[model samples]
Target: MSYTFAIIGRPNVGKSTLFNRLVGQKLALVDDTPGVTRDRREGEARLGDLRFTIIDTAGLDEGPKGSLTARMQQQTETAIELADALFFVIDARAGLTPNDRAFADFARRANKPVILLANKSEGKQGEIGAMESYALGLGDPVMISAEHGEGMGELYDAVRELLPEPPEEDEEPEALGELTDEEIAKRPIRVAIVGRPNAGKSTTINHLLGEERLLTSPEAGTTRDSIAVEVVYRGRRFKIFDTAGLRRRSRIEEKLEKLSVADALRAVRFAEVVVLMLDSQTKFEEQDLRIADLIEREGRALVIAVNKWDLVDRQPGQIGALRTEADHWLPQVKGVPIVAMSGLMGEGIERLMKAIEEAYAIWNRRIPTAALNRWFEQAVQTNPPPAVSGRRLKLNYITQTKARPPSFVVFCSRADAVPESYLRYLINSLRSGFDLPGTPVRITLREKANPFAHKRKRPS
Candidate 1:
């Protein structure tokens, strides 16, 4: 197992800022607002040549049982238990408080290696506070500023002392060897479950995981940051990301919510397939449509998951009606797979998984050059290009450039003259002709170079 370090501190002491700096990304949400982080977030951290797993936990504080703050503290305690070492950070500007002192004692009881960090100790202004931290009795305080990237070398040195030595080469040869195709295939499929607020996104994931891996409540927007969890269903591995519910831009007022929305968007971009979970009780809301559109634009394989299906009034042919609505409302992803399931009762989970796998396979599907051109010829012959300025526009040839949302380029006489309507026609035709459904199809028009122009004499 890799060495683990947990960053624990009181509210607004820059523990998250330090975590972001170490992990090299803003995986944890940071804000001027206290308690932005509620759950323990884990990331691979690197410092110089040393790499280890780092856990960023919520601020340690006292609150009544079942309160949000208390749950956050529970998350922090869990991180402390799992970590081999702890970095107890304090705000140098504000100096140590009674809460900080209390948490210091709490860390002491854990009996793990603790490194005191006097963060925001950039100048002489913080010298007094840094001196005062010595009273915590952890060790020499590593004075540094997380925001400005200062004192990392000192931080690295402190962590290295606590971590065990790297395993020798002879210890594990399989780790050194490159992964084969089968091994790669066995790797987890990266999937993100996204939707508007309180759409049972977390509950759906919990049902899939067969445990309450994520905190779920009736309260809208309980999950702030996108949380990723590994799940195995029927021997198939999946890395599922449960993202914060996205609301319309105008309705989002709080800075924290905006940050959460941005984090959810980042999750979509990184995922191979995205499942847009919709609350069946309030199905096809405006925000749900917008979220699905965003997934289509991002070129991720999409699966429309109608969650809370157990509550739906099952009329005859209701499923067919929902499918028809999906195609009509989101024509950009025509024939997209829609699975109706209740996340609360764990109904239709297998169907959801099948849809996700099918979407992923289609997303990665590639067409052969000869077969693609053959379809291209048939398509063009069926519906030829229209006349522009009384001159017939010539479409020379079409070839697929890539997949994962199959992208193609059409070499034609006048690329600029080709209208958006025609491009849409080609895209729709490609989707149908190639049996590529639901996946976003990209078609680019490129003008073929006039090779014989140089050989032709000028009219003048």
Candidate 2:
């Protein structure tokens, strides 16, 4: 029976700062730049013994309909509609501005309990602003500094007064044991849709959701935060993340864009399967390859989605040509899944979902030790390790240490002397032999230690 509070204010008023403070984490990005948050982010928050859900939203602003700013305001309005109450924050140091007065009426229109917070009230100057905030007709203002953690007690009291009484407690259910593999598989799959700016990542996700759940525009970098939404495709649950478009480092001039890129990279690392969306017109470009390489380096399962397929001129064997190009560009992940589709028109969506599930299954695949060793024997015997410095490298055996991007370790006589070319050969052979395609495979080399070496070598 937790209540939800949506923090709303004009830009640069410390709304995100208060959100981080209540959630006890830096989940929301905070910056001096106003409108740094373009989407509404929700988190479970706690204050003293009280627990509630908190939503951090974009600052309220006015823009023409269909513009990005207007869309942003719409997202904030959605958050307000979903919340049980509103935390109308104001910059105490800046005093009340016309925008603040205007938006105060906006918050009033929501018809929910609103807690007026006069933030940044550390010095005497902030006190003047706090006094001015009282004239907005929302009620008394709680003077607090979200950064320095002041006035939280008063804010907590205001929030508790608005919260409804909790329902009667019920008998607690027995704690469950560890989940089995099948049960774990039943859980939602975390898939991240990532790519360069204006690559239709958000559009694809919106198509899957069959609604404009996320704010989308033709302009690049419209999405700043990594917003995750849950969807069911063919009865399979997937928690999909819509991330900001990644650009080249040289082009990332603004501090805000840098933060957005970092957030996107974090999504890649957090996801189990990543769909690298590419524009059909600019498929296999340098930036696209770089993004794919980063995904491979992160060891997440990879799927290549050629978006805006309708824009492309159709030709015979085009799909096969795309596959060939993918293998040529990303040989490390040979046989990766590639789906060509128009995100805007919702074409090839079923194939994209199918490819994602197959990639996930392959990513989590594990090979039996006996079969792995047997395949290793044949692979090593067929293409034996090359001798270096007139000494033959004796390869011993291999074993799978883990799965989820299957990793292995091979014991050998001279681990350091093993050529990368030989390792690549073994990796490719392992992929073909064990039916592991697209997922990143890791192999660590270890030198077999001599048992009698510790006995002083007989004073040789």
Candidate 3:
């Protein structure tokens, strides 16, 4: 029921800057270099009291067929088609360029209301460029500075005139009632597949969707941005984010490539479950371990996908060796689910999907306070706390604070004195006792304050 707007413009026109300002977060990567944004990222934006979905698209340009730049432009065209309106942004300081004039015509051809945004309009030169934007044939330009957060009120007013009014409180609500738990679970799960370049990330996604929705090529780094698509499997829907393959930081030097890597990282942080795709031929590499470690640190449910299974020789201990390697290299996420499949041949996909479901359920699993304290008592009795400074560390109680990675807080006499080994022992016990394998379990220690310390003597 929300309105959607696509912020379109030529390269280096501050579309991303405006997107960050509206969303109140740096969800999209911004750089001084042109064409840093190569994919369309959607975020819920707010200005004053108006709230809507805003999409930041790659700068419009004409490129040859099948080239990287061409694919970027195709992404922009797709955004335009899906948008309810368009914010055709121009660099007011640079005045109007041939690219701006040409894309203005493109935006008009979409047959949607276009709001001309003259960004970087803080000085006399910017004002001159804003006046020049009137020549593009779009309506009056709204001069603003996307970087310094200037002229948002004018932007809000222009957008308000184009948007439909919200229904009154007395009016009937959409669909008549709140959704049940089962009905709500029917919503798609947000899953992000990420790994090193040419790891068959795209191929695996395509095979799962049963269509060629994503472009696949043998060339490394073929996917330059994170692309999202929805698919229904066995009555459970999934919203999959296909991200660009990441390389080691030393190898990534290009400005555009850096942005793509940052985009993929953002996808990982936003996703509920992240599937780290690995090439079976290459097996476990340093970067693969790093990616897995990142997912663990981010507290997202993880599933290890050993892609390109078709090419590997079927050895007697191949699967076992692969799993052992996964556990050895990525000990941070112990017992992580590992599924080997050939994306080209579409083998073991069902098993992979099942693993994804299991991980998600475990990620959301929460333990009751009574049950948690019971387990904590047994765990502490089995392995007593280590003595620090010859004084036994007193462990008082434990309780689960939240789920979705299963966070807990342990109140003790001295939180700082708890040994790292003892904490790991408790974490492992909790994982095993609660049936929470392959999910990040966060246990924070807090010192119990003396309840009587704040009391004042009565009329003493």
Candidate 1 achieves a global lDDT of 0.89
Better of 2 and 3 by TM-score: 2
Give TM-scores for every candidate, taking all chains together and pairing residue i with residue i. 0.93, 0.94, 0.79
- For model 3, residues 1-460, the per-residue Cα lDDT tens digits are 8899999999999999999999998767788888877767788898887889998998998888987778778878888888999999999999999999889989989999999999999999999999999999998999999999899999989998988995233444336137665765776788999999998888888898786556677889877768777778898999899898999999999987888898899999989999999988786888988888899999999999999898887989888887788878877777889999988898999998999999999998879999999999999999999999999999999988888899999999999999999989998898789888789999999999989978878995
Q: Compare candidates 1 and 2 on lDDT and give the better one.
A: 2
Instruction: Score residue 266 of candidate 3 by CA lDDT.
Output: 92
TM-score of 1: 0.93
CA lDDT of each prediction against the hidden true structure: 0.89, 0.91, 0.88
TM-score of 2: 0.94
Candidate 1 residue runs with Cα over 4 Å from true position = 166-184, 458-460
Best by TM-score: 2
Candidate 3 local lDDT, residue 131: 98
**Candidate 1 lDDT tens digits, 1-460:** 7889999999899988998999899898999998888767889888877788889888898889988777778778888998999999999888889998999999999999999999999888687889899999888999999999999999988887887895333333354138764775687889999999999998888888786567787889889989888889888899989899999999999989999999999999999999999988888999999999999999999999999999887889988999999999999999999999999999999999999989998897889989888988888899898989999999988888887778999999999999888888888888888788899888899999998978988699
Overlapping backbone residue pairs in candidate 1 total 0
By TM-score, the candidates rank as: 2, 1, 3
Instruction: Judge candidate 2 against the unseen true structure and give its global Cα lDDT, from 0 to 1.
Output: 0.91
